[model samples]
Target chain A: MSTAPTTEKGRRTRARIVDAAAELFYERGVSATGLGDVIAASGTGKGQLYHFFTDKGDLVSAVIRHQVEGTLAPQRELGLHRLADLQEWARQAVLQHERSPVMRCPLGSLVVELSNRNADAASALEAGFAQWRELMSGWIAQLQRRGEARTDLPADDLADSILAAYQGGLVLARSRGDLRPLETALAMAIEGIGSRRAPAGRHRAHG
Target chain B: MSTAPTTEKGRRTRARIVDAAAELFYERGVSATGLGDVIAASGTGKGQLYHFFTDKGDLVSAVIRHQVEGTLAPQRELGLHRLADLQEWARQAVLQHERSPVMRCPLGSLVVELSNRNADAASALEAGFAQWRELMSGWIAQLQRRGEARTDLPADDLADSILAAYQGGLVLARSRGDLRPLETALAMAIEGIGSRRAPAGRHRAHG
Candidate 1:
């Protein structure tokens, strides 16, 4: 039970199971989905399922990590070194959502569901988000060093705002199936942080 | 049988059930919270529950509306007329999240869960968001009329971005159990629209 899959075939089977679980859980939600559906979708038998995951709880942990990877895989493909990279990243992100208009942010939608139900799942997601944010902060820090992004606000905070806006925009877009809410927010966000080497006037800080 | 509550007592009972459902769904999630649990929490039997709602689906619709009201109640109490109102409103909004470190936006978290499972619930959530955005846009329009806000951007679009950021900020803050993400996003959002009447140079527009 504690052994790793040594064979490539075994690893493929496990990956397939995780992928199927992610799609099902993402579409039907964690509670509404069953292992049976995952098994059916994965085209794996019960013995194979048990050989990999101990229970639904175990399978869910794998799904959470899988989702984190699914969320970040694209950005990993596209570089994040420049301010323009951030804009391109957000556009690709929103366009990805356009393909599936009803889906929420891949890692974010799961946060709310598991935040209270499963500690392990929530921790896994939080760790994933922290890693993602750290990576994003590093990019923003580079931008600040290059004087392309604002320096007054902490790099981490700027990255957090970008990410927060992305998640919120996804939620709104998903809620209405409109796609405009997301497109508009991200455009404004990219503009908000993408320029202005010097400070501009604003009212009532820390609202 | 589908029926609306006619008597004052009937309405109160229905409201009580919805409130209980909202608390449970908000904490435990809609999929995890059974109607039986809702009945127990609401102190009503199965028959009474059925009288108010045809099934669990019906109850979820009511829960969505209740959550919507829960979100807007405070903001509605205080008008959204001025930029200061938006600031005060955001401060209260972030403070509300401070009370609970692990909960996402009240209506937003629900959006992900129900966006696909139940159409009625999703529709209810969309309507709620639309109404909220409309009210906010009206206030932003008011500010624009007074030359307090940038008039170049459409009032509705700014409202959408603000709502989108709020939802995303809540998701991020909830994931990390820190209020900074939400606070930063809102402060930046408030600042993003509060000024900059002239054009600012920026990178590629709308990646």
Candidate 2:
């Protein structure tokens, strides 16, 4: 468990530690990273680290949450409300990937190694993915209501499919050392989601 | 580079080592698994191991090939010629995951950690994925030619998308400890591939 930092300075220090730890964890697997390394990377003293997290698990939980926020920030900023929004989002994903040194999702990379190793970490990842998926499902549902996305399938299923494509596309793109896999995967998924034809007898009242 | 086994016994010993190394690499990880562990697990002497493989990199290369064969065996066995075959293959993939202790693609899980750390392993992985994609593309192309699959996109692009869904779905399923994500991603992808409407003014003459 993590202790809440009451003071503003304390919160900043804790955030700094979490950010450092998240980078180390993402670059190197969680198993390979130690508390000492995190302390050195964060430029924080041992006492400061102990004051915030009780153990590595607690720190990992914090890192997972931090990663979730980072992963969702762009999506929240750009929005996912319309079909065009989704296409633009896909384009942005490819662009962001192109700018990064490695082709991996910040959250999904952590999931690959930590999901089966730690119980707390696994649940934290599950919750993080749920939050991400829920946000997407909301947009998909909105689009479905507006007749801009598929309605035959539940919005959540479509949301999950899109997320899967992103994760898988990243993996393939990294493996092939090319952006086409990621680009093609996301394009295909968004195309499928937007391909819903208007119902045969229930035509839209307006464009 | 791996040496060719001149005799039946040498072939058996080499295969055993590769199988043990693959399992260890998957269950643990490539960075964590050492030569000693592989040797102990394979019940082969250190000298015998070195006789076949020049180093851990050589072993990993062989394991990559072994894993590719194992991964493609199912597709080869079931075939990927028609839309039904593709659907059945997806269903089988889900069923296979249901039977496993962990939700991961054998080849993909390897690609996650090894893609960046080792050049030889990375290239081997690239070749493995290329081979896998080629097989799927061939099947998809056949379907497209028969007018049973989408022709608007290149067959290889469709193959990559489907492969991405499988990989991304596996990660999500493992994170959530549920099969629904994998099932949904694959179902949506296949549905998209088969949704190609006959080209305008080109109707099939046969039923």
Candidate 3:
């Protein structure tokens, strides 16, 4: 098959469409954002848009994959080498949530939006999560090796727990329209890693 | 304004529609489930559906309230007296997720879906969360009175972390399509309550 002369430019245009779609999908939602919105956001025509991606579902799948890579790249590169300093890592995570007060987790939003209706979307979500879990698990395994975390709890399980706290913090933060929840959750989860016994005689002040 | 003679029956029918909508909304998401689907699911005609809900947004608000009560009722019944069994309560929450593998937390789901586009929906979500947070803060306060959780973390913050973990656990569990993350995060949060010491090793072997 002979490639069209516009193939490279078309590829760039398609990337722009996917990027715009990902943002809108994260902001409004996958089902809520229509083809017109994507076309407008990408500054591409209707024909150009359909030429790049066959339909809305195809566009969504592409967006999910695009988001997965965008989100995973930094985390994978950072490499959890600092698991021994869980508090610092946790603080950084909290800061990430703080950076975006409204959006929360884009990938998480996508998963929740598409998990039930679209199997391909669900599988893509699961695969992305699997990669993320593996990355965190590797970090946790390092912590286990260093005795930073209890050897009794499976490193992967701990990693999952940590991820849950971070993700959940994001949800709560978004719901409350405040980042305090994220900070609190992340701090507590980090605090959990080092200690099993609560500090004595510290009383909660009633408001 | 004269009430219809069949007001009681109408109310019942409306309740059924909202209940069915809530379930489908939780399972398939609010954006995915249309008013027609709600009508079909509830076995109600368009006139009846409109008589009760007026619009899809109206129906959504009703469903949000319905879900809010469904979530808060059981916990409200638990009362301040159940503070001693906070760990047990936490464990039961994880079990709830385990038992219902496919059902994501509807309130959380709604918050994710509607937080951006709909103010009324967002306010309803915030109110629901606030009410729940108050209940949880009260529980933590009761625990503090009983000298259970460490006093250093404020009761509100403690409650926030607990809620954040559970919500985050739901996201993780939903994505992985499993309950282990929920279980682990809940256990870890609970363990963090009264201690700073690392928990005893009890690794479960994965076959």
Q: Per-candidate DockQ versus the true complex?
A: 0.49, 0.50, 0.40
The collision pairs in model 2 are none
Give me the candidate number with maximum lDDT: 2
| Lowest-sum lDDT 10-residue window in model 2 chain A | A198-207
lDDT of 2 by residue, B14-89 (tens): 8889999999887877777889999999999999999999998889888888899999876777766779989999
DockQ of 2: 0.50
List model 3 lDDT by residue over B79-158, tens digit each: 65444477778777877776675647888888887855577788888899999999988888777676666666778888
- For model 2, residues A119-187, the per-residue Cα lDDT tens digits are 888888999999999988999999998888877788999999899999999999988989899989888
| TM-scores, each model vs. reference | 0.92, 0.90, 0.87
Candidate topping DockQ: 2
Instruction: Judging by TM-score against the true structure, name the best candidate.
Output: 1
Model 1 C-alpha lDDT per residue in residues B1-207, reported as the tens digit of each score: 336899999988888888898888888888889998998999988888899889888888877777788777777788777898899888988888777755577788788778464778778988999989988898899988877787779999999888977988888877887778888888888777774543323332221
Of candidate 1 chain B, the 10-residue stretch with the lowest lDDT total is B198-207
Candidate 2 segments whose C-alpha is farther than 4 A from its true place: A6-9, A115-117, A198-207, B3-7, B115-117, B198-207
Q: What is the lDDT of residue A40 in candidate 1?
A: 98
All candidates in order of TM-score, best leading: 1, 2, 3
- Those runs of model 3 whose alpha carbons end farther than 4 Å from true positions after fitting are A1-6, A83-85, A99-101, A195-207, B1-6, B79-84, B195-207
How should the candidates be ordered by lDDT, best one leading? 2, 1, 3
